[model samples]
Target: MRGKRDIERELIHAEAKIESLQTLLESAQTDRQELKSQVTKLQDALVAARAPEAYRDQQIAKEEENRTPRDQAQIDKNRLIQKTTEGYMHALERPMDVDDLDALLARSSMHDIKGPPSLHGNDES
Candidate 1:
């Protein structure tokens, strides 16, 4: 008879726990719905903020006016060409010696220095 009463008490405790869990589940669902509503409202606000104004055309026109100088510079360059006489400017130059070349390379921070030629893969010329 004592064992039967203990089991009855444990059954009541389990039922109380299940009721508490059910209440928590309902509260969580309500919170989820509120968060979803807030997210929708924020998305709508972002869409409105991103919409172009009525003066957008005028703004674009002003920007195009400001870009005239860059456009003119491009057009000026397109009409210009190098003269053929410029070709002989370096025709008589000779390769520099190691010391002079090294000095120039040091001045340039060695940014343009190339790797040494490979000797291991020269089966042909």
Candidate 2:
């Protein structure tokens, strides 16, 4: 009976030791994976550093390719705005006939006349 108990005790201890080793093994595997990822990142950085001008040109080309559409859109927007603004300015600069002014004034309640004077003058009115 004593020998049987001793054997069982040794078996329990062996199992506990195996479990601890397995935990350590899992930890080591996780550490190894993290180290491998870090090494890969470091290798990429080293390669970029070795050929910096090539890397810079590649990055610049990529940026310009991305920016082309945005630049074109901005240019189109500016041209449209400028065209609309010029149309408004040209309309403001044109001389209005007194009859047209009288018709415009009749439709609205504004009594003040601050715009450019009629080309035909008050004699035409």
Best prediction by TM-score: 2
* TM, every model: 0.40, 0.43
lDDT of 2 by residue, 90-110 (tens): 556877667655555544433
- So what's the TM-score on candidate 2? 0.43
Give lDDT for model 1: 0.59
As for candidate 1, its clashing pairs are none
For model 2, the superposed segments whose C-alpha errors exceed 4 Å read 53-125
Candidate 1 lDDT over residue span 26-101, tens digit each? 9999999999999987865665577654245445555756765566666454333111122222322656555544
Kindly give the stretch of ten consecutive residues in candidate 1 with the minimal lDDT sum: 80-89
